[model samples]
Target: MRASVSTVQDLGMPAIYLHLLAELLNTIGVDERALLLRVGLDPARLKSTDLRVSQAQASEFVTRAIIESGEPGLGIMLARELKLPLHGALGTAVMSSRSLDEALELMTRYLTLRAPHLEVSRREEGDNVLFNVSCSMDLGPLQGFIMDAMLFGCVSMGTQLTGSPVPGAAILRRGPEPGYFHRFRQHIQVPVRYESREDALLIPRANLKLPVRFSDAQLSASSRAKCEEALKQLTEDAGFACRVRRVIETSHPFPPKLARVAATLFVSERTLKRRLQEENASFQNLVDHVRLERAGELLKNTGMNLSQIADVLGYADAANFTRAFKRWTGTSPSHYRSQALQPIKPQASSMRATA
Candidate 1:
């Protein structure tokens, strides 16, 4: 079916959890590239570490894939791929650990990088460590599902880290589903509040200082710096980043950048690039991000032909655009376009699950 660019403008950014969901889709025989286009992305460009995309794009793509493929909780279905001591094939890594605190610390550290939205915080009070969860605001829906996964992941990690039963530690937020609680609650027999101030777990603080089986001080420091930079950039200029991003909200290739964009901004290319760089951004990056951001909107709502969509992004040819998509998502243009034939659904709780 043909897609209409105008229609996709209404669809917003995707939720963070959806990216994990897309990874999960691979195990279930879903063509991830087709899924990319379904959410308005060209599967080729996902490789640029600096390139940015919106949560809406991820959500729209997965949602469309689910509807078209008739799959539910596509993210959960792919849990086997994760490396954290949570749900994947390697989950056994945390299953036998030296101490409970070390297990919690290791799982928290690993998962934070794997799941960007799941913010994990730790504080010490003598031997017990107080852990707080601050979810990424980028999460739209699917927050509940991710949250559920975290609960179990936490329990599993704690058990694995300590090599002992994870006690029913007190939790701050509303508890899990009755059946879920019943199945996983042996170690979690503590009290839970309906609406607590934060989503956190109270543990022995001494546990945090305990070294993990896998230690990488250098890598941890490097990751911390990168995350800090991303956060700083996103916090200070995300408005401008998002504003400039609207230029290419779909998977289409970027236009040769109108000499007129500078003219309209009342500056020279040299001047614009200089100013943007001063803010630590480049014009091309903004254009690419807008394309990724828009990709989600387009795939979820539009009916423009893939070729037409390519043209809208100002690509000279569909093939060039397809190559770019493959870089981003490991798929082609037409296939990504083909994935956008369904409606997106709402997520559970404005409170995200991953974080």
Candidate 2:
């Protein structure tokens, strides 16, 4: 089956970051709107604060942006523009944190909410504490761009939060230096080392005690709470089975074929099956779950008959739909609908009424 761009699920980087990237592309005369549209993304929709673009689409857009602008340092440039507040809840939490260490810890724990592909870990080396940056997946060609954004973005945000250059701070990159880094070297506050063992931000232990410019105990607590909720939702949605279920739920044709769904997600049939199996799920089960949920809604809320509901649910006929519904709920669809439609009576309280 040919992949349909419209069927791709939205479960990746925040749209606000993409909006920022678009603005950057425009400044460089790259026709950002066209570029986004070329990849099936709506330019206006990218402005939403709570929207997410599909990982496949985002990957394609960034790849194209790099090729079109002839600048491989786009991620580094984008990092310079990523102000703290622009990061949403995570940003607010970090800004209001009591100390630089607290802020880093907040980011380490909640980075998945903003960028699901990256993770931050801490290590001690002499007087410096290394906040290592690593990709949670195989990012392929985008590794350099993502690393530049994450590591450099951390450096920029650190300085912004503390209101000064962090003492004894530097960036360590794993591979030989990219030629593009030199272009932005003068603008960067800290020295950067290449051919290092890991991509990390090296900061002195003393720097961790530095006070944040916007520290607020109350706001930090509130913002951290929001970040916690966002992380939970992101983790739940990050599951392969959950992602497949979402695709099934939103599919236009209803109960899309396994082949088409695999295509839409940019994976082969075998790979999709394997991934779902790893999560102890099957495509048929996900589709059936969605069908059952929709069936309940239709049966209870709509006046449509069983045949109409069956057709809407991709069932061959009412008999098959009825049989399936019975197998699932141990009752006939008509009986369930009748029960759902019956008026409810308030039950008397178990406790005695007050005089």
Candidate 3:
């Protein structure tokens, strides 16, 4: 999908991951320059892990890569190459953790710095620990690829930390099994079950206590502090509108009320409104913007009908959603989804040249 103006200004991905994708594409005989151009990304500006690109740009690039390379297992391939250092501070924190359990805890806490669209939670199921994965946004066609990379990347990184295979760790994918499922077994070296009820990792509790190969107490403390500080800076750098937009986009009930959003942000409603005004935005505008983007995503990527989409977006009915969607894009959801089946021409104007 072509990114809307608000989407270009709001959602983003870490540049490091983009760089890794570029490297992989380059190795596979894809022209990195041409690929970046297709997504309106600038290679020169992506030199640092501190930089970021719009989520629209990242998702579009992956979509194009899959089409161009004819590789449905691209995410799994990329996950195989993911080393701990590539994750920045979160990587360091994981590497320095006292044990695998602590490392997983740090990953749960700081994963958003790398992937803002995912939510990670840990629960105890008898003697096993379940690390559940949930998405905050509809990932469109990129859902399977992204999830594969993330879940497999977790396994790869865990192995790197403990310096051996993570015994009894198995993957549970909610979607249908891919034809190239062996790629997962090759990299993760563990049992994987697709068509499960949830996307999670079933980790044996005994393995959680395994000592990290690079366990450094002092470095772990320092790295965690750095991660916290960096997270604060990252939020501040996103500016007021983008920050509020993220909060709204990730809310569980879709478009949460202004007061609820304010509470989540730890500010009074009056203060939240005032800050938004300072940024030349309003809560309603951000809410509508998020709803419109999410509506477009679900329409394009999922089989959920208009009524289901309406319920997900907090609309009274499909009729109301249809009206709002037409107001946003001058087309009905059905027409939009039909058009989305066709390949979209890459637009240079869809992304900023520099973040």
Candidate 4:
């Protein structure tokens, strides 16, 4: 099944899914026990108020489950029943925004209200918008879940604004797994990038000025103060781009031109190019390298069809993706995956497993 969320409530931050998973698993009777055993996790860990499964532990656990089930879509399936709260003054502010842009700003400001470790911000990227996130905490078992929920949030907000999910979303994520890319793009119409600098959701610049029904000047005045007042007391200082990283860090196929991205940073693309050149990189090269890195991961793991893989990497079609993959590595996806499956290098960051 393509990525689909039926629940009306917003899927809260990543940990929300963990909590939901724990509860669901418990309700299912021994589901938690079974899920935990695959990762060598103790069942009691799920009982904690906020479970802290280390990255290593989570990687091992999810990897084992994927292999045993031979079902690459498990994480997304687990994600469907999650509910994100639309409560709070921030939620009210979001509901009250006059445009998707305003709603985005509301989300950017209020995201930290619930998840202190994650932050989101946006800036004009010329004819585009650049939403960004920066984070200090390791989400561990909740990483994918949290990231997926963020994507859902953005889509839902945009859909709410236009009364339908827009087909223009382009996602970027740095994770190498094909599963995430496929999982992401299967539902969202735009391209999904894997193994990119960060996760980002992009909409056209045209959507910036859209009029929202709830943007009444008086009501906005009333709600604006409430949001700002709450923001003032926020004890955490983690600012901007944590939520953005959730998408682009996995796949970065839908990259606009570096100059375009540079424009979003309020810098000339030429100047941006010059600065990146100073750093021994160019925007296109960075985007390509990220895509290649993600392609490598997708080829190595997951059983997704090659056409599906191509779609996720932002190719016009399978042939284009194949040619690019061969160009990048001088071999086919099949050959690459065959090579990648050998000995599966163990690493702290690489989420790996065998089926």
| Best candidate, lDDT | 2
lDDT per residue (tens digit) for residues 38-132 in model 3: 55555644646666665655777888898887888889989988999888898999999999999999989988788877889999989999999
Write down the lDDT of every candidate, Cα atoms only.
0.49, 0.82, 0.78, 0.53
lDDT of 2 at 154: 89
Worst-scoring 10-residue span by lDDT in model 4: 2-11
lDDT of 2 by residue, 162-221 (tens): 998898999999999988877899999999999999999999998899999899999999
TM-score of each: 0.47, 0.69, 0.66, 0.45
lDDT per residue (tens digit) for residues 37-153 in model 4: 544444433333322333333444555555555545555555444332333566567667778777777777777555545667666566666675544455544466556546555
Candidate 1 residue lDDT tens string, 183-288: 3344343444546556677765544445445544555455445545544654453443353453243343344353534542335777766666666667776665
Span of 10 residues, lowest total lDDT, candidate 3 = 346-355
Output the number of the TM-score-best candidate: 2
Q: Which stretches of candidate 3 lie over 4 Å from their true place?
A: 1-11, 240-355
Best to worst by lDDT, what's the order? Answer: 2, 3, 4, 1
Where model 1 places Cα greater than 4 Å from the true spot, the runs are 1-20, 65-80, 84-130, 134-141, 149-198, 218-223, 242-355
What stretches of model 2 exceed 4 Å from their correct place?
A: 1-11, 239-264, 267-355
Per model, how many backbone clashes are there?
A: 55, 0, 0, 36
